[model samples]
Target: MRDHGIAHIVETILDAPENMTAVNEIKERAWQAGFKAGYNECLTHVNPLFKSGFTDERSGFHGIDIEAVYAAAVDAYNNLSISAIEDIEKCLEAEDYVDRLRLLFDRPGEEDEAAGDAKNDAGTSGTKVD
Candidate 1:
């Protein structure tokens, strides 16, 4: 099986399901970062999927399943060569960065105690997209 081109975009979109106003900007950041990391070819494949406004709805539009897509993308990403994995990791890391930015912006001047708990979780605070 081949890796779907929408890995990074799917990752970002899944993180901010409530606020989509910044969706395009978030996607752009993810793509540019992925491209620099040598995943532009991959992004090209995913570009068309998001162009038709499938995400205009909060349900991500009828029949659009992000969880499945993300799983396929990540599985495919992991099977790529070491260098490709590194590039994908860079894009994934960028996604993480942007997500943190969103959280920071939402909270503004206040800090939530759960934030501290999440950070201190000894269970590794594992990243599971599925």
Candidate 2:
């Protein structure tokens, strides 16, 4: 039947390896973009927090430990960056066409169910529910 042939063509196009690859590439690029955006946003807030200050002590006038401060700032930045990336990744995974396609092809395994449980435990979207 013509309808069957059309359905076959649609299925072929959807299941094509090249199409899957392209979709994966697009998802990766989107994730990278989200990471960059989150990093930049965090940087904007963190840059001003790193400042040198002078301290008056009984011994003598001394400047704040620049090295220590820098180290702490770097640690905070790294932590913040990681948190931001995770949040963004969660948001991406929660609602995306790439994940939809993946779910379509890949049957729900135990790991998948666990991940779904985790997602449910964390609430639906990345944004605050309240």
Candidate 3:
């Protein structure tokens, strides 16, 4: 049996130009989705107050610093985006491991036939016979 490691699988994937393009596209989309989610969450918490001009005359003085809010939103967006990309990378690595393990253990063309033979020999209850 040959050893097919996760690194080998990853290297095979990365070596293909098309796969590299696809991977880049996937990471870009993940980053965009994370940024949108983070920005939307920040808006949910701050949009109402800011929409009303950040002041309520009846309730004394109220203010929201636009620069500070923008900075915070950017920071949150960056953090979320990075985390999303990392998660995507981790999933890809895990998939590579699975692929490597499958390649290492799965014999082509014989597995299905062997399984069928075993099932037929064992009967429905799966008891082995001598």
Candidate 4:
């Protein structure tokens, strides 16, 4: 897909009420589980290793523990923007894949049919009657 189209999807999800609610629920759960602070601390420990591994990818990743990576992922979930996290939750709630995608483009801000029809009629003249 084009970049702008992906951006539009992001914008739509950010505006969706259901997406917002799901995101908020995640935040609340993270707070209750003490994952927020754990996530911050995990970032400090793992980010340097992750960056180095990314920079080299051949030799730098030799000793990084798999469990540490998993912990980082779980902790980092709380750091994601609610709208971003909603992408997964919303997809799960969708009836099907295509319908889920179509929801993103159904803009509430679209212009009304009458305004578009008027623009199309701009060059027309009134019809003469017998």
Candidate 5:
């Protein structure tokens, strides 16, 4: 699993005007929730809100204020004292994400097992990996 930087994500989302009101309402609710919980609970919440490489229309998030969700997630991430936000950003950007992630994490992706079989599969079944 990967934890994207919710704070930056929320900020970028709120960057667009149409998302303004919805984000604000969510923030307000988060504040109320904090009061009820006796602490700022928004400081803890991080999970995949959306996949790394998928585009979704705003309407699909009828009740989900992306900014709020991200804000809480980022807070959770920071509080937990962990690091992986940068890699997630690169993954979201769609520009050589895997390579970027490898560089950020100081490792390389798994060897492509299908590479050797691609030509054989294509010749026999007219199917290709890409």
Candidate 6:
């Protein structure tokens, strides 16, 4: 995503509390805003393609569905990765993302065991994806 730069974060913290923790919090929020801004920019660029109704359901359903899933995955990944810790959030996000994919691809009545398996796997790894 687009990096709005540390300058903005610095300016923000400079006007706020002088505590280091507050500074860090401001920096984190700035990082998140920058990330979201970039994502929104992407969506703005792509919106025109879908707005014209040129894509019929039978022909474009799969592509549109996949794009939606990808957007959701990106949002989940962004939120999970905010702490920059590759240990906990990374694993949780992966498990949840996989579970969602399974839910989407599996037949309606076939998801019972797969979800259980995912939860068990994530639990054994020290994180509950549910």
lDDT of 3: 0.44
For 1-130, candidate 5 gives per-residue lDDT tens digits of 0222244445544454434544565566666545534322322321134334322222334355655665775465335422244436656476455434434443234343322243334322212224
Candidates ranked by TM-score: 2, 3, 4, 6, 5, 1
Off by over 4 Å in 1: 1-60, 83-130
Provide TM-scores for the models: 0.20, 0.35, 0.33, 0.27, 0.21, 0.25
**All candidates' lDDT scores?**
0.41, 0.43, 0.44, 0.49, 0.42, 0.42
Candidate 2 local lDDT, 45-118, one digit each (tens): 66677753322332221343434544554454344333323433554455452334333433334233322333
| Best-to-worst ranking by lDDT | 4, 3, 2, 5, 6, 1
Model 1 accuracy (lDDT, Cα): 0.41
TM-score of 4: 0.27
Task: For residue 99, give model 3's deviation from the true position in Å.
Answer: 22
Candidate 5 similarity to native, TM-score: 0.21
Error of 2 at 16 (Å): 0.6
For candidate 4, write residues 12-129 as lDDT tens digits: 6576675566566655554534543454456667779777422223333335454455455556554546654466467646555333543545456654232123353542122222
Who is ahead in TM-score, 3 or 6?
3
- Residue pairs clashing in model 5 are 45-73
Q: Give the TM-score of candidate 3.
A: 0.33
Summing lDDT over every window of 10 consecutive residues in candidate 3, give the lowest-scoring window: 53-62
Candidate 3 at residue 25, lDDT?
54
Per-model clash counts, in order, read 0, 0, 0, 0, 1, 0
Compare the candidates by TM-score and give the number of the best one: 2
